[model samples]
Target: MGKVAWVFPGQGSQVVGMGKAIAEADADARAVFDAADEALGFALSRLCFEGPEEELRLTVNTQPAILTTSAALLAVWKKAAPRPDFVAGHSLGEYSALVAAEALSFVDAVRIVRQRGAFMEEAVPAGRGGMAAVLGMEREALQAIVEAVSAEGDVVELANLNCPGQIVISGTREGVKKAAERAREAGARRVLELAVSGPFHSSLMKPAAERLAKVLVDVPLADARVPVVANVTARPVTQAAEIRRLLVEQVAAPVLWEDSVRTMLEAGVDTFVEIGPGTVLTGLIKKIDRRARCFNVHDPASLDKALAELA
Candidate 1:
């Protein structure tokens, strides 16, 4: 059997009709959605299934909705194939990863991410912070530009090291704008500002991380049945205490996604399966390692295809 790793995507991957196909086709998948509603004490499934787009895009709602959808898709996947040897998620998807690894209860994961979203949103006021993706730039060169443009009052730092030639910078609005200009001068092909609610995965979010630390203390975590590659360290985390610490820190830390994928590849994860809405993680993995096999499972047809390929 191929050494397999299951990965999940974060916020931007969510869409209006994400988990509807899975929920409609599979009873187990529907139950996952129902459980998420019970856990969050709201009609999250409704928002996901029938969204006005803006509400679903909110950080607090998006986090739990994406987690619930991803988890529901994973439930369908479990019925189709063997469990992966390892799991990982990008940013918000980390909660989904922990659930898949058996390190966190599904209901608790939902609640924590909901709180996490609220904290992140409230941490940085509207228009005060922003993020941008600097494409076709080396990480070192991008970092140099971010540092050069940063001022005493403005803070911009590399946030997501997604893959080669792609890096995200997040911080104060002025800082990000300056970094975007400097990045172009530093040889970036394009700089696209993100439509996000906050400057996530940057040191500006320290206060949010501090608050999450307290929340994590009360949240239950268990030893992972399968190792989970963490976004902060890009290493497998199994201990409950370590998981809590890393998750708390992850709010204000760079998402070491490229490093995480590289670590899993080095650890013999040759096949990557993205169990979520979009093919974003699969695209990122392909960019990291051309030889690695990666696929996505979001609906019944894709699930059958993956099972056939793996079988």
Candidate 2:
């Protein structure tokens, strides 16, 4: 059989009442939630199980909440699913990937993301920065366009290179608006603004990265048991020191998601498993390489489906 890869989702996957089903149904999954609550010194599990919607959506809470939920789902899947040969995550999902690799403990990861989110939110005030998705535009052309937008003295840069034609740009609000307009002029099919709290993965996030570096230096990290594809370079990362540096860089760097997926495919991974609150990574993997099989384990039913196929 071809190798299997396990992936995780980032910010946008969270919804009210995620992880509740698995937490109620399994001891391991429930313990993950309990551990998260204890580590973070709050009822994060309660927020994941019964979100007040807005509070859970806050970037500070959202980051740790999604991380905890993804970890909980992973704990459930590990009961039956075989160990993945490789792992990767999108944006905030990278921390979850590290946990899957055994490079970091779930408690440590949850703590880091909570602080990371707070730093990102604190980096730029509301309404001053933004992000927009440019569809149907090639990378080279979009790169030139974003540079042109940056030349205007506002900081605009490529953020998420999610797929072939789906690229997200982050910058000052004015800069992003101008970039979106230029993208439309440059023959992009559509330009849509995202409802994000700040301009993540852009120069505006440097302050966040600086703050994250301090947190990472003190945190304990081990070598990966499974090779982890990094977001900044789309290459396999195993060393603890390099992982620490790349994670800090990842805060303000474009997510090389397409390249990361391709790297695993080249490494002989043919099945992609997304264990998280949603199937976002599964869809992204299918878009990157259609021949690869994709599965998701969010709740009991989906967990059974993935187990039937893999276990």
Candidate 3:
């Protein structure tokens, strides 16, 4: 009844067997998997369908795995649903959104993300950097805590503005610990350190962003067929050059997810179809605005149900 925006999930949403059902049920979906494997020169599909869990969870493997799976499911669902008025994704999920918007080829996207993951992994040495989620705290209050900590040389900063009362911070392990402590003392409901490989979405990732920019230089990017709400700016982007620049910057920039959602809502997107492995984005969207319709389509059953409801 209203405009539609198709959003995708990022890391931490990846699960083994993510694309198996869709690949088995749709020939087009299977091709997406095959193409990713060929591009990456390995059986990434096998890893996604049958994971050791440990290997799949690695940042390098998780990036491509989630991108391929989301692309495969999109292959199955795109024909049945209306073309989205806009597309957006969380952090790593931005590649999936670019693929969906036809701004980047699926093969190029998978390869780029794999390299992106590697760069991010190498940006910070193991155990030195970390991230944490803070709950029930206002952004300004959390910002002050992060600023005070960083001013003292710990270098923590807000990473994800996910939704009301939910924000993620990233930086050195000591910085994260200090920020978490400050947040808790400031009356935050909770602050949990995340088990991640590095401090993503922080200035600590600048080295990774630089490496990724070099990798993207030769990759062909096309103007988006549909407007893609960008993670760095929380605004619609269609130019290939602008998207390319944003992709590089997004690595070290906070994901303005809440603002991006609000932008879409203002653009008349009352329905959101999250086409990925988990309901993470859907839950966030509900927290952002409970009245907006949300649906998940990771498998044939969910795909059919969403299509029916949307129709």
lDDT of each: 0.92, 0.93, 0.96
- Compared with the true structure, model 3 gives a TM-score of 0.99
The lDDT, on a scale of 0 to 1, for candidate 1 is: 0.92
* Candidates ranked by lDDT: 3, 2, 1
Model 1 agreement with the true structure over 1-311: per-residue lDDT tens digits: 45899999998998998899889998999999999999888899999999979999999999999999999989878776787888999999999999999999999999999999999999988899999999999999988878876755679999999999899999999999988988888678999999999899999999999999998898888999989999999999999999999999999999999999999998888999999898999999999999999888988899889889888
Which tens-of-lDDT digit does each residue in 1-311 have in candidate 2?
A: 89999999999999999999999999998999999899889999999988899999999999999999899889888877778899999989999999999999999999999999999999999999999999999999999999987997988999999988899999999999999998999899999999999999998999999999999999999999999999999999999999999999999999999899999999999999988998888887888878899998899899998899776
Instruction: Return the top candidate by lDDT.
Output: 3
Per-residue lDDT for 29-86 in model 3, tens only? 9999999999999999999999989999999999999999999999888887768999
Error of 1 at 293 (Å): 0.9
- Which segments of model 1 are wrong by more than 4 Å? none
Query: Which of 2 and 3 is the better model by TM-score?
Result: 3
User: TM-score rank, highest first?
Assistant: 3, 2, 1
Q: List residue ranges in candidate 3 displaced over 4 A.
A: none
